[model samples]
Target: MEQRKIPFVIRPRALGNAILVLVIGVLGLVMAHHPMLFSGFRRIQTDLRDTRLIHYLLEHGYLWVCGIPEHRTFWNPPIFYPVSNTAAYSDLLLSVGPVYWLWRAGGASPDLALAGWMISMSAVNYAAALVLFRKGLGFTWLPSASAGFLVAFGAPRVNQISHQQLLPCFYVLMTVFALARLFGGNPQRFWERGGLWLLAVLGGVLQFYSGFYLAWFLMLGIGFAVAAAILLPPCRTVFLEVVQRDLWVILTAGLVGVLLLLPLLNHYLPVARYLARRQYLPMYYAFNPHLWSWFHVGGNHWLWGWTAGREPFRTLGYPPEHLLGFGFITPLAGAAGLYFCRERPICRLAAAVTLSMWLATTFLPGKAIALVASGVAYYCLACLFREFNGPRERAFGLASVLALLVLVSFPNIYLQILTLSALMLCSLELVRTRGRPECQVVPGIALGLFCLKVFSLDVLLIGVCLVAPAAALIAYYWVGRRRDVGLGAVLLVVFFTAVTTILDSPNVYLGALAASSSALLVSAPRRLRPPAWLSVRALIVAMVLVVWFYDQDSLWLSFYNKIPGGIGIRAVGRIVLILLIPAALGLAALVQSLEQKQWTLAAWIVVLVCMLEQGVTTESFDAAANRATIAGVARQVTPGREAFYYRPWPNPGWNTYHLDAMWASLVTGVPTINGYSGYNPPGWDGFFAVDAQSTLDPRDVLAQWERAHGLPPERIQSIGLDRTCEGPQQTRHRP
Candidate 1:
């Protein structure tokens, strides 16, 4: 009469708890980023003057497919008239189409429907992460909630609220969870295993329909995980065993996924072929994450707004892609999880080699001597630390390092002695605790030194002070646990400081060093324990680190760009969305492992800091103006008439009249030649240039387009020029 527990199943209470947390989180996010909605739902979250409008039009295309009055076919949206299959010009949005339709059918205004859809997507993302942590990974409520909050509404993600297509990331977590359930365990029943495989495939297909960027990055992340599993010794047997046992299930699921994706591929292949592949220089400049980017939250962030107009951020080509900040707490918590988790030596070695290659490629030649000298000095210090066993010896070593740090950093002789004396006393007091590990003091010392060296007493140092301790504490904890981990952690800090010192800037080198060092420690030999890499914890750490590295324009991305579909992916930074999966898991693991009350308190403080850091200011479009403009255009472009919209002035940008023209077509079921999307039709550039110069009449522009596309003269029925929407416009017909 005992109840049998099911794997990867959420109990009712856990489900309830997750739902409650998700609701609160979603409401908080709405308040922070979309407060205008409370005044009137019509005011959607958008600047109303960016390429984001195209996403709005794309979602509206789904409403057109649902029996809305539209003269054009579903695939050929009314915009970019005469260009067939125009909906395929960007993400299909097929997965969220039904949801949009339902929201509209329930009598929500277009703007309201779009806003509701975005909020719902964010909610779904949160719920999925909660389920993944609580059920799939067996985490308790606090960590699960914390991780779910981070994945769904992290600082960087909050900056991307306008990118609705990127909002619905539930499938990313779902696919990862499915893979974990399918391969990480041995299920006795064939159907259960098959279902998991099917779930993974379904997740992939949904992601493809959601956004091309998400789909491409999801596959890339999966490939990384699978490669790690296969290459690392600990995970190899289990990975191979699953493949050997469930070859049919895996193959069948894959085939099914391909079949589901074929229709989308057919629509997108031509578009991809027509569009020029992204070049290296532009991609590296615009899409690649610079070292400062990892810490650069957007200008609108609540706590970090002041840092927005600073050095590198001002010079970054694409500001959105540079908003890579994941806050200090979550990553440090993740690093802590990595330190505690066991992993394969080969995995660590591979990661180290990869980092070495990156450092070799990017390191400045002039500073090589400095890097070497610092590295050697750090190595010697680490060796000395290893030999110390008592509190006094540890205190003396830490004090000496502090004094040297203070003296070297400050130029004034009196200031140097005073600062050095204060730091020495603090270091002595930090290590004076009997029974407590001296390594625990390392984080405090590191925090003070980093703040003093980097910012002096600047207010911005608050974030750094809060963040540095988490990293130092985590690294110190690793040192306390094992001799090799201690050495690796120390070397990692030294190498990181050396790189920053030599480059005269902070970059992703620290991340690379931490990842490589963690990997090395994971691979270190363990007695009687299974390979740490085989554990769920190790998988989470490895996947997070790999995704982080790949997002920073690693060599893997360069290799990926050579393959089909890879060259088309310009926004490589978007791949950071995948990090939410491992980040959530890592956070949950860190919270669960905290046994001391003080550590628990520190964790909470870190969480609060993260929330403030992630908080964003919302922007809303003037929905009334947009609605009036579209309606005015719709009145001018009647049924049975394809409109040609031309601006006498040079076309300012895609978001201006072009957006209105597209909206008019969607509303009136009229096709318009003016359109904006990821790519233009074959002859759009030349036609647009000629029209923008005002050399050709509106009719001449339509005629030029028709002639280029080999269309009949009768195809152009009306011309919607600059003032056409205000009054009567003459019908243009070619003789």
Candidate 2:
């Protein structure tokens, strides 16, 4: 008798696990966000302004373009009436719109559809992450489920509930899973490879349509992954082989991706040209994450809520964007993973020394010079001991010794010869090593110290010390092989420790040099086992550390700000959403290991702690009340007008009314000049000026529109204000 095997069958245990995950996840979500879930979709989560904009976009704006036949074009949304391509001013929600529309078509109100869309997206994100971890990454059920929960409902993401555009992050996990499968192993069949490539491209396209921030982040993540694959010896061959075999497929996919992205680029490029890139002051002070942010849990958390609106957490304004805490259990587990792996002892030591030195330098004064001199001395000695394979090596050693002697002889020549010589030597080392991870660490550290001295920013050595070890640890743990630490790596540890003493940022160039130096310490090849100790677990810890130290208003961030699109990124802090993957995986691995070791109580305790840490309450506003307000304002619009502008009182109290006017336009199928969104239309300031006057003259309002947008006065007129609806603001439900 021949036995036939069935594919895609769910085992009883696996099915039970899946059901359990869903049960717990849904119960947790309902408990945490009860207001949002139980409001019958008559309430919205987060800020009223953004929630309304998102609702309008999903229900009316994008739907109209897709054949609903609204009065406005796809590009020109009703709000910000006269402005062209106003939809491009923010995320268009292209991927999420279809699902919302489905719900709406199935008899759901606009609010209900939006609410359902958010909850469903969260569930989908969880499912995608579960599959990625369980099937793609080959983790067991417990770890996969735990990680999925963190990825979908982590504290950081809960805090960002107002940002409806950021909700559709399932595409990111799907893209990662596809890329991993596509590159991690060889697929004999062409169709299989092609399918993976297509999936990857679609995931990326969907991610871009979902939100630009995540799209940019996905690109960065891919670049990092590719770079790691190339640098790590074991993965390099497979990566190269895949590239060679699938060159045509890769190129075709890229071309298709570009074609798909053209519409988005077309809309965004013009806006990018018109608006000035975000400046340093705004990015650094307002949008950049802080070191404390990663530990700053939201006030909605049951356990950590007490810390909210307090020191450290409340130091930075814009609590929603800044609440990036991944909770205590995740990081502790990550550290435990590193400790259990115990593969890169030297790398871990380097991290510890660097961190200690940074703390020492931060609190202590006048230790920087001594520490720096010691670092230079150690580098010279390491150069002396290093084997001279050729004349270039010998010459470099001689130059290093001479440079140290010169520094010792003339200490006051701070900004001249020594700084230049150190930089030149660092460049020479990079060239000599050809970017071999083991050989580049010492020179990089030396160069960073010299540059810090040159800038007279000895106190800022704290920044260099803090970032250097993190980069080194990440490079070594993720890419380096056993026994790969050489004279350079050894010298780097001492150099980092000594330089740390001087630690304490115009040293943007110094920070970048230091980061590059430390980051270049990739050595040897990663082990080739399925669950290699130093593979995923170590990588997660390293990445979390990188985000912790560099995501803030630090030198690394300053360097990032100089990149072409970097300035345009309003919320670099949002990178936490991506970090949720590694954080969740780390927690899962820890729990899985604990359970395997028969430490059942510990595993349960860890899981409970994570659940509590990730728990959060959401704010919901009365959409029904706002809809009534919109209806009241809609009746005020005159018939047969191309557009009507509403002028609410120029005060914070009347802000909601201004938003209502935009909503009224949607209801009446007429364009309204009143608008609210990410980017203001050109000459919007003039419109505000006109509104501030005591009179409500149509000509004056039309003239202001004409002066700002150059829209023809005959095409638009002003509508009378609805003073009858002037009452207290709508009630909000908070849980």
Q: Across residues 47-142, which tens digit of lDDT does each residue of candidate 2 receive? A: 677777777778664457457555346677777766778888788887878888788778887777888888888888888998887877677777
Ten contiguous residues with the weakest lDDT in model 2: 357-366
Count: clashes, candidate 2: 7
Model 1, span 1-735: residue lDDT tens = 999997897789978875768665765567445655575665667666543454555456565666665533567776777778887877767786677677877897777777777777777787888787777666677777777888888876767666667777888888877876775546779999999999999999999987887888778766666676676667778888888999999999999999999989889888877764424565554666666666677777777777889887777658887787766655666656545543633223224332333332221232333333333323323332333344444344445555555444333222222233333233333344324655546635653664356343444344445445665677667656454444334334433433444354223334334333433344343342232222323323322333223224354344545666776666666666766566556666666666234487866665566555567776777778778866766666656754555342334454566776777766776667777776677777755575446465555666677878776666565544443444334334445
Give model 2 RMSD, 1 decimal. 13.4
TM-score of 2: 0.72
The candidate scoring highest on TM-score is: 2
Question: In candidate 2, which residue pairs clash?
Answer: 368-502, 437-522, 459-504, 461-503, 461-504, 462-503, 462-504
